[model samples]
Target: MEFRILTESSDWQGIIGEIWRFKGAPNDRNNPILPSYWQFLQIRLPELPETPIPKLATLSWFLREEQKRDWVDHRLVSIDPTLHVFSPTTEQVVFFWHGRNPSQGVIHPDFGEPGGSPWYDERPRLPRLRVEPSVVSNPSPGHLMPRPAFSPALTSAPGQVRKPKALSIILPYHNDPSHLFVPLQPFPDTRHTQTKTFQFPSRYYPLRFSQSNPNHEPILTNDTNEAWPASELEGLWLGSYGPHGTEVLYLHSPEECRINAWKVTGDVNVPRGVITWRFHSRYQTGPECIPPAAGLDSLPESCRIFKGSAHVCGTGFIPALESWIDCIVVVFDRDDIKVYWESLRHTSRYRRYKGRDISLETVPNESDSGIRVPPVWD
Candidate 1:
């Protein structure tokens, strides 16, 4: 993940956001992502100290906690090109802050263990940001203004849109590392550093996370009340893409009887944002069934199967070189989603995306996953 500069002022403060690059797979799409500020912080951290850090915006900040999270996830997981697997991460971001010196016994222990110590034994700890209510803010000219790379995801809840604004949120500062500052900018300004030093893994600092929109509905199209069993698969899934890597795919059953496989992440051959393959429930009829490819087992005996057409394209995805190929699909629980392309004589496997990196809330009425709760970080 990288933050690209969108605009600038006298210093590193200006419009900025993160971008995810595109990687291709076997079944590719036409959308080649160049630069995308996919989201803007509904609530932002107080800026870290200003510096020459290109991707790392330098500014001072104060942390706060919000009883409610109006935030969303904006993260990307890079699958190993050969291993065909994604690295798993915990929902928490941990780092060290404040001084590491041992505690003193001057103050009352009622406040904390070693109330006398200015810093809590100073070790790595999990940080949470909570935006307090009653904290309205005005945009500051000295700080970086955030702009969405694309349009920011702004719905605090499904069907209810929330507007982005400068918030004077406070991160409660305890006697130790916690800090609560008003006006929403980093405390103790450091933009005037004369040394001009540039280094990383700084003495001790922090890590970050961007939660997916807890409220945005992600159902492709739910026209019917009782969706097909495939509707249970209506979330993020990863499809195998040969040696290039494992590309991200989203399976949504629309029109009640058909399943459409759309590329959430793809490589150059099939970039992303287009349907790779889809099948109608009506076509899986008749007694004769085709055998599986890619050395996969033939019988789950009771799983649903479908015959479909897989979309294909050349290396660069030239419009004229695009065509559809015969393919078969398999749905064997959440762990095994498979697709076999007869033209390539290969079968691609899919599974529930392990990357909790990013995702919007599943559509409420369109899905049956139960009430989705945002991770409790703040």
Candidate 2:
């Protein structure tokens, strides 16, 4: 009844990648250093009872899935579909975006009228599913979809638990985290040999993605920041901040009032899983929306600014000198977004991340050096 863990990176280069479970780091943790993204990333399965969810036996099944030949043999690292939905518990890492704040009662665009009313609690609640061993015809690889009728691995109990706890999804850009709240359409492809043998229905829904919202046109207003919705900046974005080079970020709006930026990959100072910055409307009506002409000339003439705060920390996040600095988001249409940290006194640009094709292509032939084989756990 536990959801297993895998390396944040899907690569096979040494110990940077390995499959693990709920237990903490192995003793002698120095051997295989866990990826920096680990702290910010964890997946949980639903407590729903009716779903024909099978116990995903960890190691032996992974070995059986391996068609042994060479250590260099390349294989597509497919994510376990069951790990998509994130059930946030009190013991788990509480994300700022997951706060129980009042939302504007928005719904996914695809859900239409029948997609049901917004949850009374005003948080995202993916539909409880009734899954069957089915194949997705021309499914978008790695896309999470749901059409009220079913989900991939978990099923809903009829008239019992009406609203399952909504989950935060983890999408990796080569170990850099990303999340999207599009729509969940069930496309279970239980076709793998071992999966078929064990009757494990595939939950990895392959989705067609768009790096840019070609159809979206922002509407500017005075009182309401209607231009800034959860879906407005909802995708993988690449941005640069001072010495931290270019890092990946995932943007989600927990409520209409704020857009939370979760770091997927970042510098030694800030690291992943932290809220790098978020946008709020308090300063939008003030003089702050008018961009300071100093270094922000690159932004288009048509830009709207929403004020926010940036997270600052020391190297390795030491001393807890964390400061919430003032910042602003310049929304020059949907495709082009920029940020200026007043305290850091710097400006940066952002764009949608068009994903790259990667393979977890290699594992060390000898186990003596890199990562010592972890002892079997209960």
Best by TM-score: 2
Which candidate number has the best lDDT? 2
Worst 10 residues of 1 by lDDT: 76-85
Q: Per-residue lDDT tens digits of candidate 1, residues 1-378?
A: 223333322233443323232334335331211221222211223356477664432332212233333442111111101101111111111111122332111110111112221112234332233322221122122222132222111101011122121112212211222111211112222221111341000111111121233454432222323234555566666566776555656676665668787765555456454678898866663214555344556455545567889988864344656799988876655445667788798777776543332243332333422122322211
Residue-by-residue lDDT tens digits, candidate 2, 1-378: 112234335432112222221223433211112111111223333344477866432221121122454543224223322333423211111011111332111111111112121212243334343322222122121222222222222111112122223332322222211111112222322222122222212122111233445665554444343544546666666566554455656676566756777665555567554678887754574443545642665544456777788888854443445678888777765555777777666777776654422232223334422222322222
- RMSD values for the candidates in order, in angstroms, are 23.4, 18.4
Angstrom error of the Cα, residue 104, model 2: value is 43
Model 1 misplaced regions, further than 4 Å = 1-228, 285-288, 292-294, 354-378
Clashes of each: 37, 11
- Write down the TM-score of every candidate: 0.38, 0.39
